[model samples]
Target: MLRTTVARLTVRGLLGSRRGLLLLVVPGLLLLMSVIARGSSADKQQLTATILGQLGLGTLVPLLGVVVGTGVISTEIDDGSIVYLLAKPLPRWQIITTKLIVAVLTSWVVAAVPTLLAGLVLYGTKDALAVGYAVGVLVASTAYSSVFLLLGVVTRNAVVAGLAYALIWESVVGNFVEGARTLSVQQWGLAVARAVAPHGGISTNVGLGAAVPLLVLVTVGAGWLAAVRLAGLTLAAGD
Candidate 1:
């Protein structure tokens, strides 16, 4: 069935192709930043917090999620190859689910692991910061992957939209707009960090109670919508 095919394809594309190389770039950058941060005799706490919050959580995680998530479907759609599967008896939801799983896992490995390593390099188990950020990255990775994958399925402009959400909305506006902070994924991940971090080490614009529900809602709701949209997905002929 399409599900099996999708699973096979997802694994192969994620692990075997040149596309897998893209997943390495963010984590590699994280490592590089960690080294540079260590050399400055910076305030270890502030440096750790800045790297984890500003770069790791804010930039790298979302960028990896967008790349992996959209790569799962967008490449195929662009080449008109999705029709090979869509034209068959396979249900489109299967493809969406398999791709979602692959994208989420890829995002976690590339974004989350490097975050923990960077945390360790910067702070070394201090205040459980590494563990906290790792958890937040996983949480944010799931939601981001779902949203971007949906964008990939539905729009040729998926990367642009994903970048806008990650950079402009989450990074730029979330910093200034108090209400927007409540709705942002960065804030949601920070909420998870607030829960896991030692005492006051981590804080978030959105409270633990509100953030937990919003994270669940956004991640699950977006995933569900992605499956539904994939089922009804359409592909037009050559441009």
Candidate 2:
């Protein structure tokens, strides 16, 4: 069970700030584009795929991941307030787990919900496109939250690193390079989406066999490593 106090604190830190307003911007634009696309005579499948895949999964989810995931721990670490939390008797793993849950839930609310709404507006559940991409967004958001949270623990420049990975590596390189696609979280997510939708419009280079294990590894490994790192923070500061 999540400690209600830690979870509540994390939720407040995430939603009760200007960053929370910024998080809503992209999702709003996604919905607007969906509304506009709904009236157009363009192909619905192609539009849904492009909007949900490129904008929803590609841009919004990772950005939100960076914002929410990093914000959870990095801000406290930076402001020197994390010392208070560490000084308490709480298990290091519980703190990391609580924050991870917050980041994942925040990412889901901001990114996945909008993707689902956009998919519905653009395609109206046709070909299971909305549900497919929503599932993709959910999976991608979880992975993004895990990886970005690890970055937050390890680096002050977590947002920059996340952007470099998401935009530069995943968006630019993963598209042109075959090897890069195999290593991409986005592709892993698309693999899940492809399974759910099973439509040709939603393409994935990775298979479920590979994607599921990779997702599990990344999520569990990152959380475990983050807990280890946090456990040492007090000792490192004293030394």
Candidate 3:
């Protein structure tokens, strides 16, 4: 269901624009902070857990998700360029999937790579902390792309809506509300990290059994929804 033509245009729009700078800057900040943290006198394992788990996974991953995820398609819709995709004799699912593929792969490089590098800088490879959090960030990146892409497809204020959901609901509410943690992408990622590095001191409210299924469900479900919604958007635009 991948289309190179659509994927090429999506990459140009997402990375060849000013927003591409953000994709670099955010990850740059994480690396810088990690270097600074490495020089500190704090416990190495604790620092790794806090920085990689909380800052990298909880913050940077999701923020990049919103940026890359929504950016893939929202700008085209806003500038009335999405008609090009609709004009093609292609299925809407292929269109959404192609854009989502770009978002996920871009996010892995921009966000997940930094997590791995930062994890190493902060705590080395002891207990596989770097690889573990990097894997978690990878998973969260995919799920976030699908979800925020759906928001981009169905809403006019995709950036604003995505930021609100990520900052307010995912970060804040998901932290304070007990029931919210179960559904948090951040928490689910933490679960994966725990599994990857069982001795790495990673901790989260979710267990791997539930988190695995939830992650799969959200990623696949949101992508499917975006495809369905995209058809409606094409119809609405036509009329």
Candidate 4:
């Protein structure tokens, strides 16, 4: 069972902050765009792909994952409050796992739900476009939460590093460099989306064969490493 205490603390830390309100911005914009795009004469498939693929999956999920994932642990670490939790006799992995659960659920609720709702409004499930992208967001959110959670454990600048990876690496380099695309979480997510959507509806650079294993590796590996790191965390001496 998940540690209810840790989970509750994480939930409060994430949802009860200004950053939590910031998380609403992208999803809100996505829904607003979906409503406006519905009345335009533009092609439905293209609009869905552009909004859901580029903005929703590419931008929103990762941004929220960084905010929520880093917020869950980094804030505690920064304020020296995590030492109290670590001083307990509890297993380290349990704490990491509990925080991971909260981060994934928060990202899924904020990002994936909006994507699904927007997809429905934009295309009304005509080609399963919304469902497909929702799956992509789910997969991407898990990986992002794991990776950013590890970053939170190991670094004080988790948000900056997460932003660099999401914007510079994933957005800029992944698009321009063929090899970089193979390693991108967004590309892996697109591969999953490609499988669910109608033929030619979704596009992906990496095949499902590669995407699945990479996703599993990144998500599991990052979480495991974070648990190990937390096991060795030291508290500074009180002056």
Candidate 5:
């Protein structure tokens, strides 16, 4: 369901916007924090967990998801230019999948590189923390991209809605409301990180049994939903 033309346009739109600046700025900030965290005399493994697990997987990935996902199509929808795209013979699902691919790749590049680098800086290759979180980021970015891309399709406030979901639901609620942790992308990613770093540098309430299914469900379900929504697109509705 991928289309080269749709993919090219989405990439150009994403890079030409302020979201491109964010793609650079967020990674720089992550690397800078890794430098600062490196000097800390705290327990290295635990510190690595906190930095990469809590901040990297929990915060940064989803934030970039919001920016990249929404950037791909929300601007077109908001400006009423999506009508031209819809007028084309391309299947709506193809459009959504192509944009979802762009969002996933963009979010992964900006979020995963710094995560791997920061893991190296803080706790170098031990327990494979660097690779683990990078893998975790890949999984989480795919799921988050699909969800936020759906948000972009269905709502004018996709960015704001995505931020609230990332911060409030994923971060705050997932922390305090222990039961809700099962529903979070952060927890799903942590499950992967926990498996990869089995030497105990990281921990998570979620396990592969729950996380794997949820990740697939969310990613596939959201992509399907976004396609369904886009198939019904009208200029007035898109805006």
Candidate 6:
């Protein structure tokens, strides 16, 4: 029941709307950059790392997650339409789970698939960089989608906040500050890559054991919090 409605809303928000175009744009840009870089005198190892670490996971994954995750509920909340659904006989957790599932799947497709292809184009299976980064993107996408989706439910400036977290915290601070790296999803995913990648190819500040726990905790915690938030969600009236 609630799951069905949330599923309908999630799919519609993903594929049956203008926002779908934005989803298309991110992956298209990744592939385009991969193609253009193929023309240059780029070192395949550096190129693959840059694209996967910086562009694919660092930029596109979070961006798409913010868009798709927030699109599932924030738009409805913004328009005061969620009330109709909330008024029904449905548990809030069901809605949250359904939307979260949609967000996770969408994020994987837009972020992870292109990462593999870009990795292939750049590295050509060298040192297993392609597969490693692909797996990293997949794992990171799940965690990111949950975090951003929770943000969507709890904040009006979800996109702004998500971007700040993705670009400023993860990209800027994670690189400059060693401590920040341990707390970053980018680093955690990189840890996963490090475990699977050929020796000395992929590396992260956080180890695989720590990263796996953090990923699961953040994802599940955010999702549970979102369910609680949704249960008591209130709409602001336009004055």
Name the candidate that leads on TM-score.
3
Off by over 4 Å in 4: 235-239
Q: Report lDDT (CA) for all predictions.
A: 0.81, 0.85, 0.90, 0.88, 0.87, 0.83
Candidate 3 lDDT over residue span 46-143, tens digit each = 99888887777877788889999899999988889888779888999989988999999999999889999999888888999899999999999999
lDDT of 3: 0.90
Q: How many backbone clashes does candidate 6 have?
A: 0
Q: What is the lDDT of residue 184 in candidate 3?
A: 95
Per-residue lDDT for 92-194 in model 5, tens only?
A: 8888988998888888888887888888998898888788998899899899999999999999999999999998987788766888999999889889877
Candidate 6 residue runs with Cα over 4 Å from true position: 234-239
lDDT by residue for model 4 (1-239), tens: 33898899899998899878877887898899999999989988998998898877877777888898899999998898998888777798999999999999988889889999999999887878899999989998999999999999999999999988888877777667888889889889999988888563898779999999999999999999999988878433232
Clashing pairs in 4: none
Best by lDDT: 3
TM-score of 3: 0.97
Candidate 2 segments whose C-alpha is farther than 4 A from its true place? none
lDDT by residue (81-167, candidate 6, tens digit) is 888877777777888888899998888888888888988887777788888998998898899989988998999888889888888
Candidate 2 residue lDDT tens string, 1-239: 33688888878887788778878887899899999989888888987888888777877777788888888888888888888888777899999999999999888888889998999999987788899889988988898898888998888898789888888877767666888888888888888988999973897779999999998899899999999998888788778
Among all windows of 10 consecutive residues in model 3, the one with the lowest summed lDDT is 169-178
Q: Lowest summed-lDDT stretch of 10 residues in model 1?
A: 230-239
Model 6 alpha-carbon miss at residue 11, Å: 1.4
| Tens digits of lDDT, candidate 1, 98-119 | 7888888888888888888888
Candidate 3 — number of clashing residue pairs?
A: 0
**Residue 54 of model 5: what lDDT?**
81
Residue clash pairs of candidate 3: none
- Between the candidate structures 4 and 6, which one is better when assessed by TM-score? 4
